[model samples]
Target: MTPEEKYELFDRFCSNELSATEKETLTKLIRENESIAKELKLYQELNSHLDTRFTSEKEEEALENNLKAIGNSHFNRKATTKETKMIRMPAWAYAAAASVAIIFGVYFFGQSSPTYNDFANIPELSITERGNTEKNSKNAEYAFNSKDYAEAEKHLLILLSKDKNNTEYQFYYGLSLLEQDKYVATTRVFEKLYQGNSGYKYKALWFEALNQLKQKKYDQCAALLKNIPEDAEDYLRAQELLKKM
Candidate 1:
């Protein structure tokens, strides 16, 4: 997309004027293009600065000066706090860009299973004791990040055998199975996590939803996504994916 087109989408996003489909498309576009991401970040920061540009007190002078400084860094045009009118845009939460479309094609335009590439942001492995450099830990970290799920599963099993109560190991083990399309094994792992009281309980539900989504089981996916409360870290992304699905 052209810079102008991207800015238009960015404006619509700030104003909450885009449809859910448009939002998803714009989001995917921004993620796939670094230039667009940078542009959007600059726009949001500019919008945030402009929101506080006009203030009436002497202490407000610092804020106004800060806005000028930001504009100097990010904008090509000149700006003064004394400018008579302020540009206003509707404010909304900026959905994080850490979300990647793991699927091959954008879901906004098609009726296909979401892929592991689009949604999963596998956490970095720091499984062993901080001072320990075990072979299983090193191998698991490398295998998982390299998308070698089979290798990851082998090492993870070794790690889990030694640390049976490690929920983090169990969690990544499930993800490894899921990535390898071991649906039955993956379900077993996540189901155990979902039933336990670990910090990963809610996250297990989110991953199960992704599992269902990858299988095109929209009803099951929707149900799992709905079970996630607003306080969960994945809640916002779950809602966005739910809408697209």
Candidate 2:
């Protein structure tokens, strides 16, 4: 489609004005064309930002009236001074200005502080493969994977009691506590794991950093994230998050 037609379709999609057939077509295009998908994502972000920033209808109406008044005054002055025919500003000029505002707004909005959910890529809990055939292990696995952190925490506590030195259990138990906002317990569990030599050492550090992030302790979070080494699995993600901070 032509650029103008594509943008019109984007506008309609944002406004929820697309018919079912048009929606299907747009979905297919988004799947097949990376550029279309990226553009649509930006369009959605811009629309959401605009909606939040200009929530009052009265405010929007006042802004539009002011723009029209300014346009008319400028054209009327030119007509009187130069003896030239007054040319009214087209309605599309207002729309173009709004579009520019949307672009700049999205840019600045993107620069805002990041949240915990933006970086918390929670891995699935799977403890059954390591010769753990207990019922509590199975329940813990299921509950944690299902995102029932409270239930997972209960089962994990029982599992850890039976196998206290299991770093896997300790690490995931920390995650469960973090999910439940038990910050003190969460850090206690992760502190032991990261202080020891185990596969979960760096992983514990990462999650602890995320816990600090959730609590809005940026300094503590950044300190923990800095401890994650270059060879660690979450190193790149930690670096990215540090840049945002």
Candidate 3:
């Protein structure tokens, strides 16, 4: 589906306005398409943030009361000697004005460019099945999964030293560098991986795009994301990110 259509569906879904068939379709998409699921997750999160930031029942109530008071005061005012007239704005008009302001605030917030954190869904590192049984391997897995990138980097470096050609080590090592903002080192690792024939090729490309995204390099990120073919694991995610771009 086109981005516009997908987003429109998202809006309708969030508003609980979807018909039975549309709801079914959306449910199937979310279940079968990882990228759509992630997109919907992000969409819901953005809506929640907008609601929390812009909408307050108490504030709306106060504004409505204030508008009522102002209207009543204007109506009660004595007419001038020349019999000048005044028009009191309707209560709904005041509410509509407040709604417009909030809508504009949400519009501008939505218009802001997407960030790396918005798209980076890093997979958990697990090398225990590889039967390495090495301390550094275990430590790297633990640190990376726990989001301790510094510790992860240290262990990953040691692991890579012992197994320089291990793509799994290299991939997670690249991720560690990325989390630590070692942009130059991160891209170098990913570049090499994507250029190779390993299973990490497209995966590396995806993260490389995210690396570019972190640095706000829109053109380069878009180019990298477009290089991800349809059969790649991250193709759907790449398409979603491209739409945001």
Best by TM-score: 2
Candidate 3 lDDT over residue span 17-102, tens digit each: 99999999899999999999999999989988888767787898898999999988776664452254355678998899899999
Query: For each predicted model, how many residue pairs clash, with residues at least 3 apart or on different chains?
Result: 6, 0, 0
TM agreement with the true structure for every prediction: 0.53, 0.60, 0.59
Task: Quote the RMSD, in angstroms, for model 2.
Answer: 28.9
1 against 3, candidate with superior TM-score:
3
lDDT at residue 135 of model 2 (Cα atoms): 98
* 95-213 per-residue lDDT for model 2 (tens digits): 99899999999876765777889899889999898897999999999999999999999999999898899998899999999988999999999999999999999999999999999
| lDDT tens digits, residue span 104-198, model 1 | 23454354445545676767666655866899998998898888989999999999999988999999999999988888888899989988989
Ranked candidates, highest lDDT first = 2, 3, 1
Identify the runs in model 2 with alpha carbons over 4 angstroms from their true place: 1-90, 96-100, 103-107
lDDT (CA) for every model shown?
0.81, 0.92, 0.91
- Candidate 2 achieves a global lDDT of 0.92
Best by lDDT: 2
Segments in model 1 whose C-alpha atoms lie over 4 Å from true places: 1-116
Give lDDT: candidate 1, residue 71: 76
TM-score of 1: 0.53
